[model samples]
Target: MTAILSVNRAQKKFSGLVAVNDVSFDVREGELLGLIGPNGSGKTTMLNLISGALRPSAGEIRLKDERISGHSAHHIARQGVARTFQLVRILPSMTAEENVMAGAVFARNRLWGADAHGLARKLLARVGLDGRADMPVASMTYIDQKRIELARALASDPRVLLLDEWLAGLNPTELQIGIALIDDLRREGRTIIMVEHVMDAIRTLCDRCVVMNTGTKIAEGDVAKVLSEPEVVRAYLGDDDDA
Candidate 1:
């Protein structure tokens, strides 16, 4: 697989407190990479940094040999990197299809605007929202909101997709649908980095896992191996000695 994005020795600090320390990793083309850590372990912070919402104190972030560090969020977004927030980004008054059309902005160059709406319909359909396209977000549940968010992200036609806590709050049925949509995205060859706590979802979707602790990387490898590591277990299970 080809390396599409790389973070080398990345560091981010605020008020002399380090949030992400010397993190290094590479996302290969068409690979689903999982980021896992205990609460307050810098998972979301790292995601924010890479997505250009925050600036790193130091380090190099490359998108296929092009330096992307310090670039604005919108600039990074235009470079084929799209992220869906933990909270839904849809507007309550807008129809689900309209929400997705918001994402299809600037995509007309790809299809002359003739097929873009068709593409949005297909994305909505894929996420099981075909019948709910005209429904207002205020009338939808959390699960539907998330599914629409995923469709919006895909409208970018991205090379790398970063999903923040995509499975955080949902019922069993909702979880199943969420997982299925993510699986479908992967099957379509989108390289995804998912920071999620649902171990079952991670195991079912990610090709490998990167575990972090106290703002630093502790272990990384195939899902089962990393999940079984002593340090990995300690990070998630807690170290009682210090407490």
Candidate 2:
């Protein structure tokens, strides 16, 4: 399959500190590409670059062959790229349905009024929050808030969905449900880049994996193979100490 998104030698610097350094990868159309590494490995930074939340200091990001590196976040969202934050972000003052409607209203195709409301309800149900559409986001549990965020991301009908540790804080049961929901999205042919620490989810969901360390890519290949690489092991576990 052709690449739906490409990060060409992307780099991001904050003052003199390099947050993401010459990281390059491609997310194929309909493939769930895993971006995994230790803390401070620049995974979220990479997502920010792709989502237009941060402009790259060097290199470029392309979506369907269109350069989007310097574009604004809203512009990127309006261009069919939607994302869920590592920490769930929602409109605290908005009802579940209204929050989701915000996505549709600001999206690429832009829905309105009843159309947005209808889509919001459908997405709320899709994320398993059926009758709670009238409730404020603040009243929901952490996992439920996650569901709302995912539903909101989907409301835009995004071509590429960026999931930044969407499964981070779930318990065992919730993890299963979260994995299944993501699997359903994958089966529906959604192109996704997932930044995760959960190895089980990485093995279960990703078609390929990209491993990063200290802001640079260390490995890229099949999940099992990449996980077994010596450098990848060192990046995560720190040099066996005896060796």
Candidate 3:
């Protein structure tokens, strides 16, 4: 498989402290890559950098063979990248259909005209929100809100989707549903890079996992192996000697 995204020596700093330090990895086309670590481990910062929400402090990021440093979020979206946040950022006043249609407007660029509404309807149904299209966002449950969030990201028809903690609040049943959705997404050939805290989802959904600590990569391998490593335990549990 070819690499769809590459982060080489990526770094980020704030208040004279390093949040991400020389982290590098490649996400292959049509594969699910998980970025996992303890809290404040710079996972979401990396996602923001890749999706153009934040600029890297140093090093390079590439989409395919073309370098994509310093591009705006809109520019990055137009380049076929999309992302969902840990928190659902929806317009509380908008109905479910309208929220998804808002996304369709950008993704299809009005090519669909009245058909954009139709496309939004289809996406809602695809994500199991068919009956709730006319409902206001404020009326939906957490899981529904998340599905809508995903629908909005999919509205862009992105080639690469960066998901940050997309499963944090889901119940076991909902997690299973998300796993099915991720599988379907891969079947559709979408390359996914996710920063996930949900270990079950990460173990079941990813092809390979990347582990991080203090903004740097510490391990990359099969889920079980990485989870069992001393480095991973120390990162999550902490070493008293360092304290």
Weakest ten-residue segment in model 2 by summed lDDT: 234-243
Q: How badly does each model clash, as a count of residue pairs? A: 0, 0, 1
Task: Identify the runs in model 2 with alpha carbons over 4 angstroms from their true place.
Answer: none
What are the Cα lDDT values of the candidates?
0.87, 0.95, 0.87
The local lDDT score (0 to 100) that residue 35 gets in candidate 3 is 95
Of the two candidates 1 and 2, the one with more favorable lDDT, higher being better, is 2
Model 2 agreement with the true structure over 1-243: per-residue lDDT tens digits = 999999999999999889999999988999999999999999999999999999999999999979999999999998889999998999999999999999998999999989999999999999889999999999999999999999999999999999999999999999999999999999999999999999999999999999999999999999999999999998988876756
For model 2 the local lDDT of residue 27 reads 89
Q: Whose TM-score is higher: candidate 1's or candidate 2's?
A: 2
Question: What tens-digit string does per-residue lDDT give for candidate 1 at 1-243?
Answer: 899999888999999899999999999999999999999999999899888999889998999978888999888888888888878788778888877777778442243254667777888998888888888878888888888888888888888899999988988988887898799889988899999999999999999889988889998889999999989988888677867
| Tens-digit per-residue lDDT, 110-228, candidate 3 | 42567878888899999989888899999899989998989988988887898999888888999889878877887787889888888877888888999998888999988889999
Tell me the deviation in Å of residue 88 in model 2: 1.1
What ordering of candidates by TM-score runs from best to worst?
2, 1, 3
Which is better, 2 or 3, measured by lDDT?
Answer: 2
Residue-level lDDT for 195 in candidate 3: 87
lDDT value for model 2: 0.95
